[model samples]
Target: MPAVRTTFRSQNHRGRSCRDFPALTVTFNVLQLMTIAFVWLLALVPLTLMALGATMLRAVRPAAAPPGAG
Candidate 1:
């Protein structure tokens, strides 16, 4: 209840509203989302590449024959 009452007032105090500045809000939202996505990409890409490299090496290496086999 209190939060709802202050929401519009806060926007008015800052002179920014979605209706008043649609493009600005959309751009800000996009940039925020992109920042989060970029962080995840940075963290996952290296781990993914390392795992892929390990899998490739595992596939490339052949298993040795059993000791008792001729």
Candidate 2:
């Protein structure tokens, strides 16, 4: 019957669509991971600069010895 043939075609299309799902999912996950990594790197910049500045200050001004340690 024509209906049976149409159902078969529909099932074949659905099978192809299902097969394509993993690739699409992987692409989406990769994009999401990249976005998250970009955000984390962006957030880290200020902290990284602050830490670098603190290190520079330490090198510029050595800590004085404590009176009790003398």
Which stretches in model 1 have alpha-carbon errors above 4 Å?
Answer: 1-16, 63-70
Per-residue accuracy of model 1 over 1-70 as CA lDDT, tens digit each: 4654445466546764578888888999999999999999999999999999999888765545456663
Candidate 1 TM-score, true structure as reference: 0.62
lDDT of 2 by residue, 1-70 (tens): 4554445456547556545689888888999999999999999999999999999888766456555664
Local lDDT at 12 for model 1? 42
Please give the CA lDDT of all the candidate structures: 0.81, 0.80
- Residue 26 CA error for candidate 1 (Å)? 0.5
Candidate 2 stretches greater than 4 Å from native: 1-19, 63-70
